[model samples]
Target chain A: MHYTRDNMAGLLRSHDINPTHQRIEIAHALFSRQEHLSADQVMAIVNTRHSETSKATVYNTLKLFLEKGLVREVIVDPSKVFFDPNTSPHHHLYEVDSGKLSDIDAEHVVISGLPPLPAGMVTEGIDLIVRVRRTS
Target chain B: MHYTRDNMAGLLRSHDINPTHQRIEIAHALFSRQEHLSADQVMAIVNTRHSETSKATVYNTLKLFLEKGLVREVIVDPSKVFFDPNTSPHHHLYEVDSGKLSDIDAEHVVISGLPPLPAGMVTEGIDLIVRVRRTS
Candidate 1:
């Protein structure tokens, strides 16, 4: 589906999110490119479109997106967290030095020995991160 | 091996750490417990032993330990980063609600289909986190 501003309102509504004008713009910033973006990156994109977004707005919007299951938070590096637009099952490949992150197809990877969850608990999700660095 | 303050000096020196009194106290707090500890927890534990340590001292000493390969940083929760005493190869099981973390034996787990390194890049490490929540 095309992730333009027009579709953002409906998408947000479907996700049970209040599609305010600012939220739509922030959602468009993340969904349009379908890339992993940090809060700063999202702000940078949204700011180009309009000047109404404050840092707190962008942060709150992102947190709302996370809570509504609209985006996944990727924390490969502690300092630089990324919000992944694609929520499909997948792993991550992180370039440590460059701080670049990309998806690794889950179908191509095999992770075994996942223990049964403790009684009264359910599995939320699994995150596998492969961190790499350039030969120095 | 017992992790006591007396041994921390030698351990620090072996890892090329300076083994200052504060460093040894901090190291002993982490290694002696052999559990994942947040910076605050480390501070709390060290504060009881002595009153000379500051917040900056605790943070810098932990950074030094991490750089010197004496500890591992676990970022399960964004706000509460943990310092792991055990450096052995292992994964993590994170309790979403209780904020409890435990080691998962990497040997029992089989992770296959690790792609070859990119040209001139090398693999730093892989982290696998199993997140679970209480059935509520």
Candidate 2:
């Protein structure tokens, strides 16, 4: 599937976002790469060609995308957070030392036997993260 | 099962962490309550009576505790990170609306059908978080 800037704008509109120039660029960066990225990384990519986007704009735009349900946030650890483009049901595999992350299809994973939720509570989403290390 | 400051010292020693006064207080704040706490919450608790602990100290101490396996870090989402005192095998249930978090014993849950890891990679840890919301 081709992810053009035009397509990014369309995606943003469908998700009820304003599709500003910077927003479209940020969305294109994420959707086109289809990889997990931190806010710092997102800013770097958007400003690689021209130093136009500020750090605050990158952060604000990412937060906006999150609020609009256009991306998923993956917290690899306390200090690391990545924005994921694919919002479909899935899990994550993180390379500990390398800081690499990839998606794990939810269909192949089976998680069961969890205790029932507390009274009046309903499930919103389940996040499964498997951290791995390179064998010596 | 008693988690007193004295025991906190011993626990720190066993884990090879230096039991400084602030470190012990931080440990007590986490272990005594056996609850998930953020650095900000930790600092607040450690200084609830006496304003002694600095934000940097609390953050560094928590990092030390994590490196020494004295605690587990729970990332409920992008903006929320909690330090869990219970390090035994377990999962987590997070309240999306109220931001309450609880532990799920790993013994009762069964996870299967994950795809094989890429060659040369070994599993370090698996985190399963079930996000629940209060029924409206």
lDDT, candidates in the order shown:
0.89, 0.91
The top-ranked prediction according to lDDT is: 2
TM-score of chain B of each: 0.93, 0.97
Give the lDDT of residue A11 in candidate 1: 94
TM-score of 2: 0.90
Pull out the clashing pairs in model 2: none
Model 2, which residues run further than 4 Å from truth?
none
Instruction: At residue A37, give the lDDT of candidate 1.
Output: 96
Segments in model 1 whose C-alpha atoms lie over 4 Å from true places: none
Q: How many angstroms is residue B75 displaced in model 1 relative to the true structure, after the best TM-score fit?
A: 1.5
Cα lDDT tens digits for candidate 2, B1-136: 7988899899999999989999999999999898999888999988988799898998898988999999998877667679999999999999988888999999979999999999999999999999999999
Can you write out model 2's per-residue Cα lDDT over A5-46, one digit (the tens) per residue?
999889999999999999999998998998898998999999
Estimate the lDDT of model 2: 0.91
Q: What's model 1's TM-score?
A: 0.94
Worst 10 residues of 2 chain A by lDDT: A72-81
The TM-score of chain B in candidate 1 is 0.93
